[model samples]
Target: MTDNPTTERKGHCLCGAVKITAKQAPSHVGTCHCNMCRRWGSGPFMELDCGTDVAIEGEENVTIYPSSDWAERAFCKICGTHLLYRLKGSGEHMVCAGIFGDIDGLEFTSQVFIDEKPAYYSFAEDTKNMTGAELFAMVQAQQESD
Candidate 1:
């Protein structure tokens, strides 16, 4: 926890029905290109690492869905904005980067489930890419060690 003023950021849903405050937001952004993500919004899911230090001003306006066996997703109930993807075990929240408008030095660091990414669309940022199988393997390795 560095004394960076930008670490604490605030954002809201498209219709202003729900507001978000991330107390320790990271500057790195990533994308998930799994099939579920594509079906969720017809494209890759862009996310920011918001961890668990998040505050929801209008919690009643958000709806969460257990998208996978180990992860869940949420969105604004009023405007249908895809809000976040959360990890079940660690309780980590990766919020949608679009909702935060713009941060000063955010970086497109990595792309997961790259093998599932569609051929028609691509990013030219030269990010670190990980295939879906590699992602699961890494998770399994970690879980076994724990």
Candidate 2:
């Protein structure tokens, strides 16, 4: 956490119900091409390597909508702040990178579910494309290592 309170990054969902504060900016950011992400974010939702230390308050007011059997989308019930989308059966939370207050130098490096991405919209930005199978395989491998 930053000692100089002024440097702390702060943000909340569209609704003031779900507020977040981070001491430091995110280390990485990228977009997801998975259909669930598209439907949840209206566009490729940005993900951040936030680790677990990120403090999330007012969780009670957040609405968790299970987008699929394997995932859940979280939004603020009062203000409908699209806060987070968590993968099912995992301890990880994919936070929206765009919400990081005044963050800069973010680069999109990979696009998961590229094969399923809509054809009408093309990604002009450079990023490594990964199929759903490829991503799931990697996730499975990580789970096994844990």
Candidate 3:
């Protein structure tokens, strides 16, 4: 396994102004197939599950928008960096791990909401598929456990 504290990573916005740090690597990583994720991310949305080790120090330069009734999306105001998509009620965050330097041994495990994915594109890789309701339920269960 990769060293714990040494595995900490850094990520920055498109223009390199906004930066983020996470000491813990993701427990789960995947591409999201929801319409909002696609529209906001402009493609398959990559989400990293870092349980609160994620921290953004440059909040002044970022803009936040409520993308859904239960979530918020954050981006760099100046460079339009897709920073994070956090579920308000669930307390789960889907961060753009691309900004972070290549994480050694990192892997993409699953894809959620595959049924909602656009017809124009398809993923050849094997992944677990879950509907929106199922995904929401999973998140809710996690929150309750926490």
Which candidate achieves the best TM-score against the true structure? 1
* Cα lDDT of model 1 by residue, 10-69, tens digit: 889999999999888888888999999999988999988898999988999999999889
Stronger candidate by TM-score (2 vs 3) = 3
Off by over 4 Å in 1: 1-6
Writing each residue's lDDT as its tens digit, candidate 3 over 32-140 gives 8888888887798886765566788788998989997988989999998898888786566667878777666676568889779889988776667788889889978
TM-score on alpha carbons, each prediction = 0.91, 0.79, 0.84
Question: Please, what is the whole-model Cα lDDT of each candidate in the order they appear?
Answer: 0.88, 0.70, 0.78
| Error at 30, model 3, angstroms | 0.9
Between candidates 1 and 3, name the one with more favorable lDDT.
1
> For all candidates, what are the clash counts?
0, 1, 0
- Ranked by TM-score from best down, the candidates are 1, 3, 2
**Which of 2 and 3 is ahead in lDDT?**
3
Candidate 3 Cα deviation (angstroms), residue 103: 3.1
lDDT of 2 at 115: 80
